[model samples]
Target: MLLQLDIFNILIQGGKGLKPLAYRMRPQKIEDIVGQQHLVGPGKIIDRMVKARLLSSMILYGPPGTGKTSIASAIAGSTKYAFRTLNAATDSKKDLEIVAEEAKMSGTVVLMLDEIHRLTKPKQDFLLPHLEKGSIILIGATTENPYISINPAIRSRTQIYEVKPLTEEDIKQAIDRALADTENGLGKMNIELSSEAMTHLTQATHGDLRSTLNALELAAKSTAPDTKDGKVHIDLAIVEECLQKKALVQDKDGDAHYDVISAFQKSIRGSDTDAALHYLARLLEAGDLISVNRRLLTIAYEDVGLANPAAAARTVSAVTAAEKIGLPEARIPLANAVIELSISPKSNSAISAIDAAIADVRQGNYGDVPDTLKDAHYKGAEKLGHGTDYKFPHDFPHDWVKQTYLPAKIKERQYYHAKENGRIEQAFKKQYDLLRQAQRK
Candidate 1:
């Protein structure tokens, strides 16, 4: 009991009266690092590189909170070389040159540059020559696609390692560790995490460890004073208030923008109106105009095709209205369009049928156009009888001719198969069946 009290006191005082809780939780060795065992696992590429002291210039590309910075720090810690850090967002070309001169004078240097994609072309070029000479080993971290954002020359020299987002298991383990750690964590508080709270935090964070930790920290602090019998029960209501409502919502320009939009599309596809509306509200709150417009356009065809052909037309009209009206007034039409398309019945194979037919023709399944449909306007057309077998549909009953329109090679091919659900497609099916039946007789 006394030992536990001392541990709690030490944690409350912030780790030997020096390091804070966040710093105390920082991994000291590579093995202590969580979530990225694939890269730093025993005998893996990174482990082999570190063991052999053959660390190459490399880029760590992944979404935020997947341990890119931590891995780079671990590499530097494990190495005998001097370590230096800089942010490309604030550091200039001169700053890089200064580091280069120091590296030349002081022997090997490992320069870990955060947000390397933010560096200008010249700044990136400044590091190229030094990198080639082995005076400095570059470790760059970026959230963007490196091929499009990084300098091509710099990219060619450096090896790229992609870090994946942490799994739900990873996030759960991290939270548990934070709660149990005596130093720099809520060691003294017996905080109970409700299942709903845990699930909500995991989903809301979108695989960001930093955000998750911050959220847990906030939740604990907020619930600390409300404890009873040395146990604080954190319910869904507490989590929703402390984390969800004030969590900065997901910004369209921010890191989780793509994730939120993907969730929105999936919700509509799954026919979950509640989930779809939640994402819609997030996007609308963020003021993401182009993304909203683009998604509405896709939803029109992908989710509302043929069922209500007017949905696509309405979506296009909404886009035009958005352009002319521009927000406040435009938001109304956009919201209406999104709701209309989301709730509307859906069909997809209408477009897929045409695509399949084209593929068949390209593969030589259909060799040529029918003789009746061939051009007869040329000078020598009379001798070849291009239009000789043609029968005008107007001359037949119901303005339709009982004839084969397909080429000889693919005369029996049937590409389109209409769905029986939508009203629009039913009409097409009736007319098509009648025409084919008459042609057969």
Candidate 2:
């Protein structure tokens, strides 16, 4: 009868018995929350807002599991404001209006939008009027940069709070808390985590609290049941088995992406084919197709221009091919193009010369475009003698003419410095020298 009673209790409890502990263990109050002391710690912006009961619409920008949602929930729990949660991934503009209407009827409504960056421009525009009127206090959480992802109009209205990742120490403390809190944690299992295991788990988690807790739960459950040891021991080997695969690689979203691409560009510029290929592979593998293409196109113009003009042509062809073929197979043509570009002799000051000339114009360092070069197509343009003295280069020898092209303020400005290493550039150098000598005579 006693044995039957024991089996019945186990059946009744089941997985629900263990899951509640995990759910209930979530920090109920902001004070109990781990990490993010910068925002939630005493005297911080969020801390002051909660304490003063003066909440406003804001954006929470950070990586995953950084307590963005949790902080929003904590605010809802502690305040008199009505909290409405919606995911931007699937939530529609109609849904937002519904929430706005609710706020109109009720008191202050805190609308928490998760993955807010995913919201389309039209959908984002829906919230603008309500945000302007302060009808609903929006709390938007996203992993991407709010500046890049959020509409400028919407961004202008919201205060952006940046959240940092949890530290290794913070992760360790969270693990210990999970083990000690029996109600919603591993405390009931009497698990004893070795220093080696603890270090492994902490380092492996990469400052994500949710992942660390989940790993701990898995390790604890995998322990041998027959062991007479009063305390459940988790070792490094056990942790390795539990984790199995390596942790996902971290991506630095904005400037870091550009920085990596820049490195790859410079490698190709310096003719370091190995380094260029490595960076290309890294970006391709990481799903930076648009970025890779942008750099490749730039390389085509700025590094391979004229010297081996085919290099630029090949890059464009490769990009077109990749667009049509897409991944795996596309990688091959892209790789071949990159290799050809790295080996090609290079020259490219054309764009830079134009850029400098434009800068001079913007600074008012130059006058109008030479009257000779102004458009003669317009009716009045010809009357103004726009093309009066224009020398058509094609009508002259070598499709070149020795004439003043710069404006009066910067007539002597030297641009288009030719690189002499490539045959195309060497020809250009010889032509330019001859033109200058003729002009001098």
Candidate 3:
């Protein structure tokens, strides 16, 4: 037991010896944490919890490098809890069993479960009982939404806190801390980062502190020292070369994926052409052509139904052209389709009419089909008085005939109410009103 304790201490205290700068610069205490001020600032719930040593099981959710794991480690440091880290993707259920056993022996254990959304059902089942008994203080970290991706049973037992992306100043603060700290940072070595380099690095990382630190470390390590002063000078050129290109933070299967698509559909539905095109660009940049295509097609039928029926055919053509040409070129046709849909007159009457009719049917309002409208082409259908009084519209002027198409119970029921959203629907509405007037006459 003493040997195990010694090993644990070594693992926790081994930050100074050779390790990644990001890992070494991890905040050891709550005050050292750079971002997430909402949860951990003075008088905040997490801060109060840590100060009082009354931490609870929590799942920290956010984008990558937003300090979920670091916050958990900080909590363990501040609360003096026995902290054990495990990778939910690689670690098996047996590892959790071991942690639970350790918690029993140690009285309490703060288990930092990284990528916890990947944890299997059996593993989660194992942890729940322990979580209820207060034996395991689980800190589940996930980049995806806990409500969407996490097991409901597990999520219900943990308080979920969303860790927001770090701001430029917050990231700069972290960069400065890493550069000046003599113990874990590169302060011993003389390194001067230019103002332009600082701005470029901070902005290029897109609020990801881990990427910023890693880029700083790369800039410091890769650059040769000046011969005269023996100091490393990181300029814009050096930072740019080290950082490469900025990456878009989009998860193909996560909340970001749904968010962009949702915004795209809403933009088109709301008739914001600029917003629609902007979201379309985002989807194209993220290489999510399928969602772009599927959503545009849905908008045509769902939002623009009957108002501009031609838009549906045009959208299908656009999708086919995009699929055939395949990206880069595909974005052109897709953009055209998005613009057309956004500007088209919007109406939902077709869908609403069908839905209202279906509701009445579901409520047991349906009756037998009218004899005139029933199938009359069969040999014995005529004997059943089907189509006996049916009037062919071809025999009447304007191909119009007013007759009871619905059952006697709902003979006067009207479902479709056309809107004058476009010229096509306007003409239909005019003809509909004339037909009703003629029927009254």
TM-scores for all predictions: 0.58, 0.52, 0.59
Name the runs in model 3 displaced over 4 angstroms: 1-17, 246-441
lDDT of 2 by residue, 1-441 (tens): 011224323423654554532344567667877888998899998888988988878999986766787788777777767888899999888999899789889967889899988888877778888887877889999987898888777788889999887777888888889898867777788787777777766655456676667667766765643357676778767765665533222222223445778888998988899999998887776455656787899998987887777678889999989866767678888898889889888776677777887887688787678888888987888789898889889998778776767676676777677777688778988887787777646
Q: What is the per-residue lDDT of model 3 for residues 138-192, given as tens digits with 9 covering 90 to 100?
A: 9999987799889989988999999998876898899888889999898987989
Which pairs of residues clash in candidate 3, taking residues 3 or more apart in a chain or in different chains?
none
Q: Write the per-residue lDDT of candidate 1 for residues 1-441, one digit (tens) a residue.
A: 011233344435545454434455666567767788889899988888889999899999997787887787788778767778899999888888888888979978989899988888888778888889988999899987899898888789999989887776788887888889877677778788877677656656556777677666656655544424766677666666655543234332334657888888888767677787788778765445556778878878876677778889998999879866865677788777877777877777577788889899688677678778788889887688787788899997778777768888877778887776578877877888887777778
Report how far off residue 436 is in candidate 1 (Å): 15
Whole-model lDDT per candidate? 0.75, 0.76, 0.83
Question: Between the candidate structures 1 and 3, which one is better when assessed by lDDT?
Answer: 3
Over the full model, what C-alpha lDDT does candidate 3 score relative to the true structure? 0.83
Which pairs clash in the backbone of model 1?
21-184
> Who wins the lDDT comparison?
3
